[model samples]
Target: MLQVRVKPGIEDRIRGFFPWVYRAEIASLSRKPKKGELVVVRDFGGKFLGYGYINPDVSIAIRILSFDKEEPVTPELIKKRIREAYDYRKRLYINSNAFRLIHSEGDLLPGLIVDVYGEYAVLEFTTYGMNRFREVVLEALVETLRPKGIYEKANLTAQKVEGIKVREGPVYGEVPDEIVIWEHDLKYLINIPEGQKTGFFLDQRNARKFVRSLVEPGDRCLDVFCHTGGFALNMKKMGADEVIAVDISEPALEVGRKNEELNGLSGIEWVQANAFDYLRELDRRGEKFDVVVIDPPSFAKNKHAVPNALRGYKELCVRGLRITRQGGYLAIFSCSFHITEQHLLEVLTQASYDVRRQVRVIAKTFQDKDHPWILQMPNTLYLKGIWVEVV
Candidate 1:
């Protein structure tokens, strides 16, 4: 293994179990390192800090895998970590079989993601370092979960950043283009080959179930950026007479319609249009709904885009607030780490003041328990939502 030492101050954070070392923070290295090479990180005084894999090409140069000196970064370690993550998920006892088994840094396995949908397992390697353990990871998943098939979804952004070359297809056994997976009492069709974010937004599973409590029979509801109608179907299942689901992807909407039929439910209008434009048109038509949910894609990919992201969020909040009837409920979600819960509150406050609607927060929700987030790495806790009652 290569040996590298960081600047004096950087050691404190690494010692605190914060598992990233920026390139500029390095003071010295025994030799030039190759990308995805295992390296032992040390402090300025030559005291060991942690063991991690180094990526010389990226700003996030090193993602520490194990802080313990005894536990090194080995193929065996990857197998062990996968099993540990599986045990943790089993403990969660998620109502649905589809869940995030490994949450990157949250599971202490940086740059790896594993999501299980029924008899299949979907894998994504977000970092070049973790990609080195791909074979072991697949073997571990087979030994642990014993899924009928394993599929790899190529993340374009990760490809560009980390230079991981993986074709999007089944790597083990056979995976179908579509599969029906049930969450709570509703069934959904997941398009693994061409769907967004591993074919479905499983992170919002809890929020989808929670929204049912606010919906009443014959109530009208709106789902903006509602990929595959996760929230819309739940609203209808709760006896809402009318539900409208809007998304930009025609394929996703098609699946959403199929999901509506899969559950023997009806009256959910699936529309394919830009969510922002649709929301503006709804406000123009003076349409008011009893409940509304705006779950948009990540507006901010990185920190530089947060200002514009806030503007987008504020616009959604404004439209969501204006069209919600008095005493009705509205929920706004941000799925990016760059947009914090505080940012959501600030934007919602500004939007409410602009629309002249005083609101009180009724509830707040986050990614379900299966997607565990480490307090040391705030980025792991990416998805957050705020529910407010319009007055």
Candidate 2:
């Protein structure tokens, strides 16, 4: 195996169990290894540190695979990690089979995500190392969970950044054209082969349930950017009077409508249109709603775009507030890691000011427990939700 020699001070971080060994931290390398090749990491004094996967191009040069020198990076290790991850999920008391099983670095398995939807498992690999472990990891899941189907949903950009090519489609079990699953007492369908991030946002499960708790019978609810109708289906199940789910993608809206039916919710109205434009039109028409949900995609993938993303988010909140009835509730969210909780709250405050409305925060929430956040890593807590009452 190739050897990666760390700088004088680099041993401190690696010894402290820090997962990433950036390129700058390395003083030298004995030999150039293939991307994702397992390498022995050592300090400048030639003291053993650990084993890890190397990627020559990225700043995050190597991701430590194991701390124990004896622990082989074998299929058995993958099975053990998979087992531990599953056990942790079951402990959460979330009976739904549709949830995140492994949340990449959060689960101590960086660059990999495993979402379980009933009998199927959707795996997304975000790094070359995880991609190299694909077969072993899939075998682990199959042997441990005995899932009916498993699929791969590789992140093209992440792969590209790691100097690797994208590999699409099933890597193990047979992946059908459409996969059905249940969440928050509602049924939904997904096409992992072409669907966004395994065809649904299972991470939003808890937030949708929280929104449902605020719903009342005879209440008219509007769900903006209602990807696959998560909030809409939850509200419908909560016995809302009516539901309007809007999204830009016709195919996503179709999936949302199908999910509404799958959940036995026939009262939902699906609208295919841009959420921002729809909200503006509603404002112009003097339309009002008892409850409104604004859950848009990540507007700021890069830190530099945070400013514009905040502006966009504020505008959505402003429109949502304008169309909300007096004393109505607004469930707002920001999935962008760049948009900190404080920043989102400030944006919402400005939005309230724009509508000349006084709003009181009812509740605040972070990402669901399924997407575990490492205490030292604030980035893990990306999703933020705040319930506000327009007074």
Tens digits of per-residue lDDT for model 1, 1-391: 8999999899899999999999999999999999999999999999999999999999999999999999998889999999999998888867997999999998999999999999999999999999999999999999999899999999888899989886689999999999889899888999999899998899999999999999999999999999899999999999999999999999999999999999999999999999999999999999999999999999999999999999999999999999999999999999999999999999999999999999999999999998889888888899999999997
Please give the range of 10 consecutive residues that has the lowest summed lDDT in model 1: 159-168
* Deviation from native of the Cα of residue 246 in model 1, angstroms: 0.8
Instruction: Give lDDT: candidate 1, residue 27.
Output: 96
Best by lDDT: 1
| CA-lDDT, candidates in order | 0.94, 0.85
Candidate 2 structure quality by residue, lDDT tens digits, 1-391: 8898999988987788777899888888998678898888999999989888889889988988687889856667767888899999989977477889999878878888899878888888888887888878888899877888888776878866985566777777687889887665667898787678777887787888888778898899999999888888888888888899999888888888788777777889999998888999999999999899999899999899998998898888899999999989998888887888888789889888877999999998878899998765677789998889989
What residue runs in model 2 are displaced by over 4 Å at the alpha carbon?
Answer: 8-16, 42-50, 68-72
- Model 1, TM vs. native: 0.99
User: How much is 210 displaced in model 1, in angstroms?
Assistant: 0.5
